[model samples]
Target: MTSFADLDLADVEEVAERREELLAAVRDHAGRIAYHIARVDGGDYGQRSFSTDDGEWTVKYEAGDLEYLRFEPRGGGETYVISTQQPAEPKALAEALEDYPAFVAAYNDYVDSLAGMLDSVEASFPQVESTESVVTERDRIVEAIEACCDRMAGELRRYEGTEYGSFAARIDGTRWELKWDEDGASYLRAGGSGGVYVLSQYGPPSAADVREYAPRFGGFVDAYNDHVAELELDLETITFET
Candidate 1:
């Protein structure tokens, strides 16, 4: 049996093709032995046995071992076993059994070759980001946005009057705006200068709006993060300038 452990590359399809050919040869040899046994028996002693090609018996290897041979009759019956003590009657079957160990070694070699190939293929793949890392990044972005909003709130407090007031910030070419009127009604926008408001409320600006419209910001964060990742930029390095 050939060993593939030291090979840098092994073609899985080629290994499988060789495996099938070797297995087929084993089955063919078993079939020939069954034919000879049936011919010599000639339906004697009322045993309704015939050649394997006649569909009377099927030759198969034992699962896992592949070295053990057995003949199963059609429609389910006892497995046919030839006695080694009566070597003259079923000499071919006994002789074939002796050659099965070599077949077993070859079959196992193919299995190992395919397994090594699978390992190589998997190792060559790029490592994917884990769920923990993804969630941590999202949380970091959210925290940064929240911190920027907190600073904006502090600046907005300076304009506490019955008049229209607005504060705007720019981060990484994206603009975020917060506007309030005499009635303390406020709205927020995060996009281009002319982008539509993302959050609008009749009363004063509340942190609850951030929670309620979190899905909206989450989508924005995902898109922004993707862009930054493609540019090989760090999200933490981005800051809002009001």
Candidate 2:
């Protein structure tokens, strides 16, 4: 339900202002942007480091000099994709790291801004009636569900000669049910549990009948499908096939 615009990963700024942080940010991006030590003070670039949303990470590297540092990246938790290498320029390395404090801070903030925006977007559209744009979309899915119910009820009504029917979305724990009786339609019901919720067709009473008229529920299927098609959700689409 969340959109990309709602996230603001760009809102982050580098917070590292210490000598160690400068060295760390350099090492983190070093693989992509190569660097190595010229001075003998740090001793063979073993403690590679960089800044992240929460703080910093310094992976202990091998005690060897790097002539051609390759960008071997690692995961940055939920915030960044990090990597490290030791280039052969102490002055340039220190300069880069010195500048890195602001750069890393700004860079991380940018990414965080986007993440924040996405978070905001998702928070806005939590359910069926959450968005105005999705109102008509809901109508379409409801129409499909009603159509399915009608088809199901038709079989029951034709044989049993009574008025009772239902339609629903079958998620693992959320079973939203729509029903109708002789007194007309009733309020919709949304069920939640740890139980499995699979999309399945009911009624028709017998397997032979289900095989015969199962195609009739396609309209309801389309209604639910179209409702999702309208939203262009990024997570997973409404996958209901019964």
Candidate 3:
């Protein structure tokens, strides 16, 4: 995965060209998969199970978006990019279509590689019986961050009419509002300037609760920073210049 810290748009033109090509290829490949689904399911975007050498393979696409491709044995697989339509800009769309063949060949190679891995993996780690849904550490972390952000939003709602420190409620647009909790934790909610916020409790400097929460708060900030790095998003600037 690309990180925000490692992302540099110095070669914007070249990168954009490659991105369009990749997207176009995925869209075309999706159409080919849809063709196979049409034989039985009439090409509708839904799950279709087919027989493979190892076992059954299930492909699913919802609302024209490719969701997942899972094979038998360990029920392991990978998800593909979502594609609905071509870009409105003609030149960019043309660039993507031009690299369609390259994308298809690469995608085929990836599928073949995954199939080989699955065959080997089945011999190495047999499937365990379980009725419970598996929750990974990554999933838990993502959920925690989401819950924290939601709490921040709730705080904004709870204290929108109140004042806190130098921050005041300011509505920029229909859904964009800036406010802070009663405890002085400021928040920029909705619109383009959105981010997670947490309260800083009002009390004496040496308060016991404050000291305890300080490190936890730092951890929360670090988690957000990690998420930003994982996504390769520019926390300071929200724009993509062409």
Candidate 4:
């Protein structure tokens, strides 16, 4: 997502309040304290784009004297903010130690949480890595996909000769052709899983008004062809569910 150093304070004008607090703390501590704002890159901020619609937000404080904190509302309300500086309040020996330990612990937890968020965001929406894993995984998925396409060819022909049968095939992420007949013709497609299956009459209708009762065709295809404007799967695992 975004990098730590790359974060712009002006972009998150809302944090001006905390910035004011950090500034006051820096001034109060003066030469005894060192304050530099470090950005909150990677992790929660980047993985999940903050939303102004929902009310979920998180405050991530920076380590050391550079008191940085970010308020992120990735759920709905302007998600995620980050900044750096020292602890805002003076502490007695016990409180100072407690605060220091607490800060350290919180920072560590933030780091861990950020790591998990990175993993989750990656899982939900994968990033095309440009490193070594890129080529290796790409090749792996490509070979698997190629083998699948090859199989589809023969499988397609088998269905072609079958009597009034159907199959589902994907074209990118957009559309799928619910095909029938030895000759290419009509198909059904949708957006994602169980989106909507609309029949387009390319050839003859296997059974006219097929949608009236059930999706019937001479061949099979993914119900969501039109929705697959582009192919997003760098790695695809295909299993004939039905």
Q: Write the number of the candidate with greater TM-score, choosing between 2 and 3.
A: 3
Residue 112 lDDT, candidate 4, scale 0-100: 66
What is the lDDT, from 0 to 100, of the residue 176 in candidate 4? 42
| Model 3 per-residue lDDT tens digits across residues 1-242 | 12122325566676566556655655566656755454445555687554433344455766554665443432443223333433333333333334334444444554565555545444556678762333343334434434564555454445344444222222332132334444433443333344322232231222332333333543444443464464455545667789
For model 4, the stretches where C-alpha displacement exceeds 4 angstroms are 1-39, 42-94, 120-242
RMSDs, each prediction? 22.9, 23.4, 26.1, 21.3
Best by TM-score: 3
Number of the top lDDT candidate: 1
Minimum summed lDDT over a 10-residue window in model 3 is located at 197-206
Task: Give the clash total for candidate 2.
Answer: 34
Q: To one decimal, what is the Cα RMSD in angstroms of model 2 from the true structure?
A: 23.4
Q: lDDT values of the candidates?
A: 0.45, 0.41, 0.44, 0.35
- Give the residue spans of candidate 1 off by over 4 A: 1-130, 162-165, 169-174, 179-188, 193-242
> What would the TM-score be for candidate 3 when compared with the true structure?
0.22
**What is the per-residue lDDT of model 1 for residues 1-242, given as tens digits with 9 covering 90 to 100?**
22223333356565445444544565566545444334444532222222342123323322211222444433453333332222211223333334345434443453465555545454466677666765555556456655544444444454344366665556555676666554442566767666645555532223444444455554544543454465455546688999
Q: In angstroms, give how far residue 52 of model 2 lies from its true place.
A: 58
